[model samples]
Target chain A: MQLDNTDRRLLEIIQRQIPLSSRPFADIGVELGIGEGEVLERLRRLQEAKIIRRIGGFFDSRKLGYTGTLCALQVPRDRIEEVAAVINAYSEVSHNYLRTHEYNMWFTILAPSQSEVERVMEEIKARTGIDSVLSLPAERLFKIRVKFNVSEVPDAE
Target chain B: MLSEFEKRVVREIQGDLPLESRPFAAMARRLGVTEGQLLDTVENFLERGLLRRFGAALRHQRVGYGGNALVAWVVPPDEIEPVGNAIAAYPDVTHCYQRATVPGWPYNLYSMVHRHSEAECRELVRRIGEALGIEQYILLFSTAELKRSSMQYFRD
Candidate 1:
């Protein structure tokens, strides 16, 4: 769907935060000079198009008493689909992607505790029979924030 | 301004700060508010859970931490919570989580490790394996970074 100006404005606003006020749509309307109902409708449409994946809280895991790490696993060429399915099933695995690499399947997961993280890895090895796996932990948190530049890039990629 | 309006302004600025020297000032101007007002809203947003943090995004390869990998582990269904908690406690483990395992690829828990050298990253993984008591895992390192952009939830 071609995003109109109002759609773009809504995207710009919602990317930051979904207004938490009772009348969030109304509040957004006030700022963007559009009607509250229009804002709500636009948001619904965006979601329907799958452009806006989810509207949820983004937390600082470090502050929330949870630690995070990025890990990659090298699966045999034929086992990509099987491995991807395994990684995608865990609730902790928020984001998983199939990438071109020696490991081939790259994914990121977030756990509430550290021990859980280790156990998950161990289980993967025993099940997959792929002993060559590397877990890269964050040495320093340089930057962590979502980016929204739909204005610059066309809506449909 | 009403507290809610102030919060809306804060949410907008916190998530979409342009990569500029005077980001606060730029945001204030865009929102048609004073810099002081923007600062106040930012403070409030920080108090709430809406804004996680404000920081820079770096290119790991450019900075020499080019060696990166996504690691996964399979913990028994009952022991997932305990194992995840133990591994996440380590400072080096930046991102960790649990996922469903596919047939032949049964590793479930996953983490991302970034290191200046490949060897260093491998060594850390070895240590994490021993530390977690999970001797088996698959280390999938990136040969190329195709796309690594933070999700733009608000964008259409």
Candidate 2:
């Protein structure tokens, strides 16, 4: 699944933004000098390849009356998987990773309210019995933009 | 506050938009709104900062960025503003934040760095440390990605 120059350019454009138009793909096609059908076909293939995990709106959950926090748990080496399963059971937990630290398990939870976030944390603690959980909410956000320079990198995988 | 229609639009498009010639058409139909109406709402969301972005979310690994790390720094409380802004300026640094620190955990500023390799990631971290003139930090490379998914809202 090698991405050619056009595919690369397409990825770059869409990762940054897509037109807010009734015929957005047609607009992208014009920009790419292709047709709407080609744009749709390429993007469909990209989605099938799992290169594009999602294509949609990313809302500021905070503005929508949601609260979230970064949480870490110190799970014993043998119990890491079990504890992670417990924490990941909640839909609020969007990301869970095993990192190289004493507090090895780190995850993020975004819920409808602050109390909902707290409730999820409490339940995780109760189920896993990992009382050494640390919830570190963001005091300030400096930046959050996840876009890669697909134009430069060749298909490595 | 979000209008009722806006909430419905958000609920419909928070997941992947169908890959079609007119991706918003089906969504508009389901929500009982015209394509123009739905797109207008999304455009408004972007203008109002309710939506951070509306586009493709790429898998970094698939796109050749195999190495990623979460670097935590222990910056002095007063310098958080300058230090955070500096880190945020880097294109490779995707997320930067000043977070609450717990006892025994003094690292307050966190940044997520992506590169082609672990060695490259380490070099970037070292350069950042030198440029920022900060000493205490830890590079927590992910040993495993237990779960990664987008948040679903208004599903009820």
Candidate 3:
């Protein structure tokens, strides 16, 4: 997906905000100097190309009384895929990833309560037959902001 | 406890918004509210700190920034604050947290780093380690992201 300056400008606009109004596209279009229909069409193309993952509201689960934890598991090499499937089955598991380490498989689970998180962990152990599951809940969160720079070239590799 | 209408708002708009001229208006119709009312409700939620942000979480890989790694450093008890602040100051460090360590895994401080390539990710780890003077640390690069979803509250 080769993004033009206008596309980058649109992404920059929406990354921080999207007006909560009857015509948010028109609001953005005005800033980009493009028509509402053009804005809509470009966004649709971005979606089709898998460029824009999501555009919506984000809520704080901790403020809403939810427990989240990052879990790591040492599944046997041959069973990584199989165990990952079992772990991904839980709705609480928001993120599942295969990483490079001894405790290779990692995932984060967000549940309504601590007990629910524990129950899901036990269930995963039981289902996957892997005892090396380690739960590393956040003791403190230092920073949690993520915003990608759109206009400038990305930092060098 | 959240009010019934507030819960409905969270449930309805937490997912993808429609890609149209009047996305919020369409959502307002579905939730039995006018566009102004829906917008005001969202404003209230933001003011109250319930809603984090109403924006797009771009695919980092798709935008040319490619590599990602979760580095856990075993910072000393006396240096946790300084180390965390320093790491979090980096733009590419999206997440920095102090997590409980298990028996064998001694690393306690975690920072998620994103770079343009795998080599750059390694470079970031080295730079952070050198700058922080942390001798013991481990880097875990995600080979695959099986699932990634934003957490939603008050789902109904």
The prediction achieving the highest lDDT against the true structure is: 2
Q: Could you tell me every candidate's TM-score relative to the true structure? A: 0.54, 0.97, 0.95
Candidate 3 stretches greater than 4 Å from native = A153-157
Q: Name the regions of candidate 1 deviating beyond 4 angstroms.
A: B1-45, B48-156
**Residue range B30-99, candidate 1, lDDT tens digits:** 7788777766665565686545743323234432455576666766768777777777766556667676
List A-chain TM-scores for all predictions. 0.92, 0.95, 0.94
Specify the poorest-scoring 10-residue window by lDDT in model 1 chain A.
A139-148
Candidate 2 per-residue C-alpha lDDT over B1-156 given as tens digits, one digit per residue, 9 for 90 to 100: 877878889989898888777778888999998998888888889989989999989989889987899999999999999999999999999999999999888999999999998899999999999999999999999878899999988767
Candidate 1's fnat? 0.05
For every prediction, compared with the true complex, DockQ reads 0.06, 0.86, 0.69
Docking class of 1: incorrect
lDDT of each: 0.60, 0.91, 0.86
Please identify which of the two predictions, 1 or 3, would achieve the higher DockQ against the true structure: 3
Give the Å error, residue B76, model 1: 39
Cα miss at B66, model 3 (Å)? 1.8
Which DockQ-derived CAPRI band holds candidate 2?
Answer: high
The pairs that clash in candidate 2 are none
lDDT of 2: 0.91
